[model samples]
Target: MLTTLTDYRLWALPRNYVKIADAMIQEILDSGAVFEDIADAPVEYVESRGDLDVIFHELRGTKGCNVQACYDPYIDPPAIFVHLSGNTGRDNFSVLHELAHHQQRVGDAWADVTEDITDRAFIKELREKVANSFASRLLLHEDLIDSAFGSGPVTAAGVRWLFDNSAASMQACLYRSLELEGNRVVMQADSDGRLFFSAANSDELFPPHKDKTQEEIARSFDRLQASADGSLVVRGGYGIQHLSGKSYTNVVLDMVLCDGCVLVIATKGRSEQFAFSDDGEYYQGSVCHDSFLIKDSPGRCSTCNEPKCSKCKSCGCPDKQPPPCTRCFMLLSVNDVRAGLTAHEYC
Candidate 1:
């Protein structure tokens, strides 16, 4: 039920998530069975836990269960514990994710077995990348994402479609889509006014290294989060936070909605610029940081920017566009279409 596994660079891994998801969806299409919004999708979700978590009730004893994709001990297939935690949180990605997992079960049984428990624990994380890849394509479907993203602006309503289908987080879905369209993205989080997740895009992985005076950063952050309300706001440390300046806003996060995706980097800071600067240069050491360019890569996008063959036409300056790159085009399309629909319906 457990095994030790080495971490592989996503680039070095033999499998390509983009391809795997496309093929998996083809398999479902080829199947004689009906593709109703059944329970086997790759990105299953629910409204109960506002936070995101993947489940594998069906993969426990399955063959490839020891493989990178089938690692969750939380749920076992065939007859899982609960009845339904299903809702379209990922919008366009959930069902596909779960379905792909089901597909993995068919081939994974005996594919490769692990000998330790940690690898098993890591399985949950592994499949997330896989299911994310699969669900994104299946729901977004290439042409649809491309056309939608290319035709107009990507909006929040577009985000709804992804949520409805995949059960993935709003940002995750956006990241996937924008990446398809040749943009890059990163994600971060906050914990006890310290650094947490630093999932940077392949391109801008350098700048955010600069550190503010850790003491001042912590105090400012603690002060802010304590008084944080509930809207996005710029803070002195780390990056940005959910609330503009509400209680508990001091230990803020770097929630930068740049390019087409979003990065929620969180940490503390003594001074605003010390903690975070939009500058691209790097200087200090471990006690310091990376260049601001690496930290804040998406200073390129603009609101109401049109969708050119490149990213947002309005920010039509970058010879390179931005993160959440073009490869993830489908999700962006879904983003745009959903936006228009929501606007038509609500706006």
Candidate 2:
């Protein structure tokens, strides 16, 4: 459905790049090409199936190049050389990316050019982007992603599902899902906390942090620590201050350490009115109102002083330890965090 970059402007990619990517995907779909699962396929196996030779050689110091994969289309049947030294996920992605180039009829011409050196860099960048797009489409089919999100909200679990089911990396899965489910942001930061790359549906909602130093950004998010399981949600004053900017509010963040880097996903909460039931019971009456409210109000129950009455102060229920208010700073599930409220009333 997203035919143009404008339809999915969150990526902030060049219009021409999007145009080419769109055409490539459309052509693949039109030709009824079945995207086979290559997640477990070896590099040699993949190359063989694609009718290409596979070779592994040291390319680290060659031509000042440290690329993980390269496709030499000048050969009779073409060849894809994958750097076995690279990470498995990265190597797999690179192979698919090169295969995409082959599928799109993009070959060594872009690489073999000697004139217009300035333009060569730009052309190479464009071609790389197109190849990445193609690889993403091939590995993570549109239909599979649609089906995953069709059941419910696109939570951290859903992203993990896509990652497990596809040949893409966690970062790739996050970025792809952002395109599929607009209005979200994904950022990758180094272990030292320096932001390396970020992608979003809207810059206004999630601006670039490239200008800030690693320490500055880390301090903004309370010293940004990486979680092994990717379940950490930084909240409270530190999280709120850093996440909520001039154009955003009710921002929720989940971070995980991936290959010595931190991957963060921030979702801007939609403001929804919540009211207490007539009975004044917090759990029973705490319902999200369909109508939207511009400004958050404490509501009638929030200010009610009916005494504890042996009930939990948090939830207004007869219990021992009070449950934290959903409106306030609390560790919530991925789904709840994604559906965070800008305002809420507690009985």
The candidate scoring highest on lDDT is 2
lDDT of 2 by residue, 1-347 (tens): 33333322122253334445656655654555434534356365455465677777666322222237777778977877777754666677777677667655743333333123344444555567666665665566666687657756666556666776666776667656665645566776765556766666532233345543333235433343433454455432122122223122345565655555666666654213222233422221112111112222234233332222222122122222222233332222223334563223442
lDDT of 1 at 38: 32
In terms of lDDT, the poorest run of 10 residues in model 2 is: 283-292
lDDT at residue 306 of model 1 (Cα atoms): 16
Cα deviation at 190, candidate 1, in Å, is: 11
Residue 289 in candidate 2 has what lDDT?
A: 11
The lDDT of model 2 is 0.49
Instruction: Give the worst 10-residue stretch by lDDT in candidate 1.
Output: 282-291
Question: What's every prediction's RMSD, in angstroms?
Answer: 16.1, 14.9
lDDT of each: 0.36, 0.49
lDDT of 1 by residue, 72-167 (tens): 323342321221224343333433444456555653321242223244434554555666666555445545454545565443334344444443
